[model samples]
Target: MRSLRLGMTAVLVGVASACSALGGDDTDPAADLAADLAAALSEHSLGDVPLGDEAQRTAFAELVAPLDEVPVVVDVVDVLEVEEEGRAEATLAWRWEVSDAAAWEYETTVALTQGGDGSTWVVAWSPDDLAPGLAEGETVGLRTLTPQRGDITGDGGAVLVTERPVLRYGLDKTKVEGTQVARSARRIARILDVDAAAYAERAEAMGAEAFVEAVVLREDDALDVLPAFRRVPGALAVRDTLPLAPTREFAATLLGRVGPATAEVVEESGGRIVAGDEVGLSGLQARYDEQLRGSPGTAVVARGADDVLRTLFEVPATDGADLVTTLSPDLQQRAEDALATLGAGAPAAALVAIRPSDGAVLATANGEGAAGADLAATGQYAPGSTFKVVSSLALLRSGLAVDDVVSCPATTVVDGRSFKNYDDYPSSALGDIPFVQAIAQSCNTALITNADRLDPSDLSAAAAALGLGVDHDLGFGVYFGQVPPAETETGAAADLIGQGTVLASPFAMATVASSVVEGRTVLPVLLPDHEVQQVAPQVPLTGREAGTLRGLMRAVVTTGSGRFLLDVPGEIGAKTGTAEYGEPGAAGDLPTHAWMIATRGDLAVAVFVETGVSGSQTAGPVLEAFLR
Candidate 1:
C-alpha cells in the first residue's frame, strides 16, 4: 500500500527540470532526483526537496525520527527509468553508525513519479523505502550485548576473581505509594546496617519508578536480613552474579573492586563505554580494565507493535582475556594469617615475600589495620637500622672487612647532635667491637662514627646496588624506596644509620633481601607478560659483597637480636630495625617504626609495623610465623 501518509511518508524530487525551465544547462531528471533523495535522507530534512504538500514534508520528518540517536549517511547508487511513463526507480546506500565497535548498512530502492506539469518528480512514500522488510507497525532500535568479564588467576592458574551469586537489596518505588517511599528506604537501610536517614532522603529525591539501592551482599551474607527485608512495602532483593574473590578481604587492596561505570569512566572512555556498564574501579582491576572488559556486541533490531523483535544486523561479542599473576594462593593466605596475630585495633602493618631465584612476588598482604590501602607495595616509611644491610655494603666498599675493628660506644655525637644505641644495648659489646659485631647488634653509633669514611653519594649508590632505590615499572602501583644525598654533616651521619630521609616499603625491603640471596640487584615481577623496565645503579652489587653481607646478616640470628628465629627449620639471615619519630622533648617517649627483613633458601621476606617498641619484639614474630 503506497498511501504516502504524513506520519511515514518518504519524499524525493528532481530539480533538473526546474533548472531547465529557468534557462539552465542540460541534466538528467532521474540522476538529479537520486542526488536530491540522498541528501534528504542523510540530513533528515525535506525543506529543500520539492514535495506535493506540507503533509508529505511532515511525514518525512516522522519517518527518520527512529534513527535520530545514531549517525546516518546515505549515498545514491543508481537511477533506472522504468517502462511506465514518467516513472523511475532510485537505489540508495544506507549506513548507520550504532556504536564505536559496530555499524549497520544495507541497500533499498524507492519509486519516483513525475508531477502533472511534468517539470518536477516526487518519491512514492512507504516504510520499505527506509529499510528493507521494515513493516508499517515496526521501528528500529539498537541493543548492546555485554561480553563476559575475564577472571583474575594466580599461581598454577587458580582462578581468583570469578562469577559468584549475590543479592542486591533496594527500594522499589513503583511498588509503593509516593508517600511510603521514604519509609521503605529507612526500613531496608536499618536491616542492612546502613544510615537510615541518608537512605530515606535519597529515595525521596528519586523519580517515581527508580530503584534506590541499599546494598549488595553475597548470598550467604544475606541470609540473616532476607526475612526482615521482605517485610518492607517496597523492598526488593534481586539475585545476580558478580566477579568476586574467595573472601571479602582476601586481596581487597591489590585486586580492587568492580561496579557500575561512573560518569567519569564513561566520559573518559571516548565511546567504548556507556552508562550502566560494569567496570573496574581501582587497583589491578582498574589498571587492566580494557583487557578484562573486552568488546561489546551490538544488534540493530526492529520491534513491531506486538513487542516481537527481529534482528536486522548483529555483531558478536568478544570475551575478555584472563589476567595471570605470580601471586600464590597458599602463600598469600599464610601471609594474611601471620598479620592476624596483631589482633583487633592494631596499627597498620604489611608483609611481602619474594622468590629470589626468579624475582616472583609470592605474597603481598596488608593487615586489617591498613584499611584497604596497598601498604605492602606503596607505603613509604623510614627504614631505621634494617637499612644497615645497605650501609654494611657501603662500609665494606670503603675498605672495611668483617674482621676490621670499629668503635661502638653507648653514646656518640656528630656536629652537636647526640646519638645513642637502643635502650637494651649490650654493655659487653659496646666499645671497640668488630665490624661484624656492630652489624649483628644493630649498633647505630658505630655506623654513624664511620660516616666520614663515605662520600655524600655513597649511601645512595650502595642503596641502588641492593635494589632499594632503583625503580621498575611492574604494571601496577609500586615504590622502590628513596635515598637522597646528604647535604649537612649531621645529615650524613644520620643517613648512615637510615634515619635521615631514607624511606622504603615492605616490597622494596623484600627486594633488598632477595638481591642478597640472588647475588645481584633483583627486580620483582607480578604480571607474567609485562616486561619490566629496569634502572641500573651507578655501582651494582657484586657476588663477593653479597656473600659477605649474607654472613653478617646470619650472625644476627646466630648471636644477636634475631636469636628467636634460630628454632625455625631452615638456615636464616635477618636484620631488625627500630626507627624513632616525633619531637625530641614532646611526649613521654617518641614512637618508633618496627621493621624486619630476612632470607631463607630461595625466599626473601619483609615485615613492617607502623608503631612498636622494637623490631625484634614486634615485627620479628610476624616474620617467623610467615616462615614457619
Candidate 2:
C-alpha cells in the first residue's frame, strides 16, 4: 500500500429542493459583523488545542460571550486536507455547521493533493466556511449543514413537491482562475432567471481567486427555457430530481419557494445537510419547516485541495414527509378569470370562492394583472355596497320592515356627519325607495341613514359575531373587515357605505354569502370538502333576520343593480357594488372597487376589481360568467 491520498470533493446529495425557501439574499450587507465574529473567534477560540479541562470550554464561551448574544460566534476547528502517498493525491471530508437553530446540520467530501500543509486553502461559497473538525480515526468532519423544508401537495392529492434524487454541478475555484469563471456565471444566471450582467459584475468583483456557486439544478435537467446556454463550454449539469409542478405560479404564495441547504446552518438543527437538502420559504413549508426537513445521511470521505471522491462510512439518505393542499384547480381558474374580466384592466384583483353550503374554498386565484400579492384574503379594502347586507341585517334585527320609509336622500347628515349617495344621486327617492329597494340597489344613503339611528356598539358586536376583521390559521392570510364607527356620525356614514374602516377581503364577503345560504354565520375555510376546520369567533344573527337579508339580496338579482345576472341559472342571489377608493397616492389608491358577491351551484364568492368603472357593467357580467 503506497499510503495514497487524493483531494476529491463530492456533495453526495441526490434529492430535489422541497422545504427549501430562499432567504432574502445570500450576500447580505453583514460582512463587518462576520469579520468581527471571525476575529473574536481567532483571538479566543482553540486557545489550548485539545479541550482537556471542563473550564476551558466554559472559558471559550466567556471570551466570545459578547458575541454569543449577537447570534454569530465560532472557532476555527481545523484546516482538514487529503494527502495521498505515491498517487500524488489524498481523500478528505470538509464538514460545516451553523451555530444557530442548534438543530440542523450537512457535510461534503473532497479528493485533492497536499499543496504542502499551508499552500492554498479552499474557501467555500457563501455560508460555507473553511474550518474543519479534529480528524477522529476514520472520520474527518468538514463543514456544518442544515436543510429547512416541509410537506407539500395539491387539492386532488397531486404530488407537486417532494424529495427526489439530484445531481450537483460544482466549480472548483482552484482549478479555474478568474475569467475562466465569467462564462460559468453568465451561463448559470441565464438558466436560473438571474440577471447575467449583475452576476458578471459580482464575478468580476470576486477578482482572480474564490469559489462562487453559479447555479444549482437537478441532474440531467434540460434547459427548456434557456436553450442558448445548453452544453456550453465550462458548463456542468448533473443529475437532479424530476421534482415537477405543472403550474408555474402554483399558488406560489401558499406553497412557498425552495433553494439549497447550507452546512453552516445544520449544526443549529442538530441535523445533517447534504447537497440534496433544500428548504421551504413560506406558507405550508415554513409552517412545518421542522417536520418537512428530514435528517440527511452522510457518505463521509476526506479530500484535499485537488478534487476527488472516496467512500468511507456511509449512512443511507432519508426522505422528507409529504403535504396535501385543499386547492381545487378548475374552480380556481374560473374564479381568477371572472375577476380579471371584471377589473376593467385594473392592475390587481382576487376571487375567493367557497361552497356556501359548506365552507371549502373550491378555487382561489389571483388575476394575472393583479398587483401586489397581499393575498386577497389578507388585503384590506372598502367593501362598498356589498356591506349593505350587514347593515340590512342590523336594521331587520332592529325591527325595521322591508317597505318601511326612511326617506332616501342624495346627501344626508347622520349623527352630525354628512353622507352622500353614489355620485351624489338625489335624495328624493328616499321616501318611496323603501328598505328592500334601498338594499336591492345597495343605496348608500339608506344604509348610512339607518346605521345612524342604530347603536354603533350594536353594529360592532353584530359584525364581530359575523367574523369581521378576524384572523385564523388556515395556512393563508384572512383579514376581517372593520365595521363603521357608530358613536360618531362620520363613522356611521363610513360604516354604512362599507368605506372608512370597513375594509375586508373577498373571503369575508363570501362568508356573508355563505351565512345567507346556510341560514347562519360561517367562516371561510380551506379544508377538504369545504369542511369547517375551525370556526372563527362569530355572532350568529337570528334565522329570521338572516332570511330577511337573503330576500333583500335576492332582490338585488331580481331587480336591483345585479339584475343583469337575474337569468343566472339555479337559486343564485347576488349584490353589486362600485366602491370609491381614495384619491391618487392616498390609501387604497384605486378610485373604485367593483364588487359582486353571488352564490349558485353550491358556491358562494366575492369578486373584486379595484377601480372598476361600474359594478353592473364590470363585476356583474363577471359573476354571471363565473357561474355559467
Candidate 3:
C-alpha cells in the first residue's frame, strides 16, 4: 500500500510539471518554430509550428483538439542547409499551383541555433514573399542597371547643368579583412553625411559585388573633398560621365523637369549606361524632346565588372541637338517685378505679354500655385473690372454711342446681386456718367445698366473674340476667360461688370492689350519660330468702336489705376481691376484679385497681384518699374 501511494504521487507531480511547461510565457522554441514554418508555407493554406519534443507536441495537440472541427495534423520534419549562427535552421515551405500551367513554389530563409541542451531550435523564418530558392530546377540571375542622363541648358545654350563625373566606391567587408576596413568605412560615412551602420550593413548584405553612388557632389565639391574617402583601405574611386544640372529652379517651368532613371531605360540598354541621357517631361524640353534628346553614339571596350570601360568604349555618345526658345530674359524679369509690386493684397494674379507682329510671348507671370500639370494660366478666378474692357468693346460695336449718357446711382443690383462703383464709394457714382467716362472710371452702374442694351450672344461672341474662353497648348497651363449666362439680364449685367464666371490669365490680358495696339487679334507664344496662321475669321471691332475704346483705355492710364505706371515717356494705355469672390460662408476675409494691362510703344505687358484690394494700387507700380 505504501509503494502504491508513492508511485501515484510521483505520477501526479510529473503531470503537473508538464502542464506548467506548456503554459509558460517565455518564448517556447516550439512556438517560434511554428511561426517560422507558417511564413515559409505561406503559399499553402495551412501552416506548421515547431514542437520541442513528442511530449510537448502531445500537449499542444490535446489543447487544440477541442477547438478544431477536423482532426489537426501535426508533422515533425527536418530541413537542411539553413543556419542561424553556424547551425541548421528548422524551416517550412509551401506549394500552390496558381493554375495547372502557372508556376507554384515557395522560397524562404530560416534561423537555426544550438540550445543549452545541445538541441538545435528553429528560431525564425522569413515569408515566401521575402524568401528565395524553393522552386524546382531553374536558374535565376540579376544585374545592376542605371539610367542615361541628359544635359540641361539655359536660354543662351549655357550648359548650366551637365553630366560630368560619376564615382563608384569599392568596399572590402570580410571580417578577416582586419579592423581597418570597418574603421575606414565609418570615416567615409562621417565625411559624406551618410549613415554608418546602414553602409556597413549594406556591405555585409551585398558584399564586394555592390556599388555605392557618389554622384550628388559637384565636380569641384567632390574633387576638393575626395581625400576623406581615400583613407579607406579597400575603397576605390572610379570616374563616370553622368548627367548634371547647374540651376535648381532657373526657369524650371519653361525648361521642364528631370528625375532619376526608370527601370525600363536601364533594362533596354542591357545594363549599360550613356552619359547625358535625360528624358524631357514638360515645357520646350517635352515639346521638342525628340529633337533635344538627339541620337546616342556607340562605344566599344573590354570592360570591368561593371561593364563600363576605363577609357572610351567603342561607341561614343551622340550629343543632343540644341533648342532655342522665344522667352525674353528682360521681359520675364520685368513681368515678375510687376507681380511683386501688387503687394500682399493681390497675391494671386497672372500676367502675359505677347508681341503682336510675330505672336511671340514676351512674358507670363502667375501666383495660382499649381493646378494639375498646368501652372497659373489655367486656374479659375474672377476678372473684376478688367473684364469690363471686353464688355465695353462689345457694346461700342453694338452701336452704343461712346458719349451716350448713362445715369448711375453709385450702386445697382442685378438678380439680387448688388455691385458698387470702383469701390463701395457713394461719391464716385453720384451722378450721370458718359459711356467712355464710365469705362475710364470703371463705373459698375454705368456698365451693368447698359448691359441690357447688348445682345447676350453678341456679348458671348465678343468675349470669345478676345480669346476669353479657349483652351491653348501653352506647355504649362492656360486659362480662357468665361462669359456669364445671358438668360438672366442680371447674369449678363454681372458679366458686363467682369464678374460671374469671367476668368483670365495674365497672358490673355496681355493679348487683349496687344489687339488694341495692333488693331488686330493677338495671341501669346513662347517660341520665336512658332507658326501662327489662324484658320478662322479674325474678329474685328468697328472703326468708331475701336477709336472710342482706345480713347477710354488711354484715359485710364493717364488718370485712373494706371496713374502710377505713367513713367513710360511714350503713349501708354492700361486698365486695372480689383475683384473678390469666395464661398458665402467662409471664415477669414476673402482676398481681392488685382490686375493691370499696359501697352507702351511696341511693347505690351500684363501684371497680376495674386489677391490685392485694388489693381491700380497693387500692379500699377510694378508695371511702371518694368516698362520704364
Candidate 2, residue 101: the lDDT equals: 29
Error of 1 at 350 (Å): 1.3
Model 3: how far residue 114 lies from native, Å: 61
Q: Which ten residues in a row are the worst by lDDT in model 3?
A: 9-18
Please state the error at residue 287 of candidate 3 in Å.
3.5
Which portions of model 3 miss their true places by more than 4 Å?
Answer: 1-249, 263-277, 303-317, 337-349, 366-376, 422-429, 472-477, 528-538, 542-547, 584-589
lDDT, candidate 2, 545-614, per-residue tens: 7677778888988877777776667877888777877776555445788888887756787877766776
Candidate 2 minimal-lDDT segment of 10 residues? 14-23
TM-score of each: 0.89, 0.65, 0.60
For all candidates in order, the CA lDDT equals 0.86, 0.57, 0.56
Predicted candidate 3, C-alpha RMSD: 18.1
TM-score of 1: 0.89
Runs with alpha carbons beyond 4 Å of true place in candidate 2:
1-151, 154-193, 202-224, 235-239, 242-245, 261-276, 298-318, 339-345, 368-372, 415-417, 424-431, 527-539, 584-590
Top TM-score: which candidate number?
A: 1
- For model 3, the local distance difference test gives 0.56
Backbone clashes counted, model 2: 103
Residue-level lDDT of model 1, residues 1-628, one tens digit each, is 3333322423343433443322124756666767887887888655476654557566657766766778889888766565456666677899888766767789987777788877678777666788889887677777888899999998889888988999999988899876788778888889999999999999999888988888999998899998888899989988899888887777778989899999999999997788999999998889999999889888878899999999888887888898888888888889999999989999999999999988999899999989989999999988889999999999999999999999999999998999999999889889999999999999999999999889889889999998998788899999999999999989888788878888999999999999999999998998979988788778989999999999999999998989999999999999999988775546577899999999999999999999988999999999999999
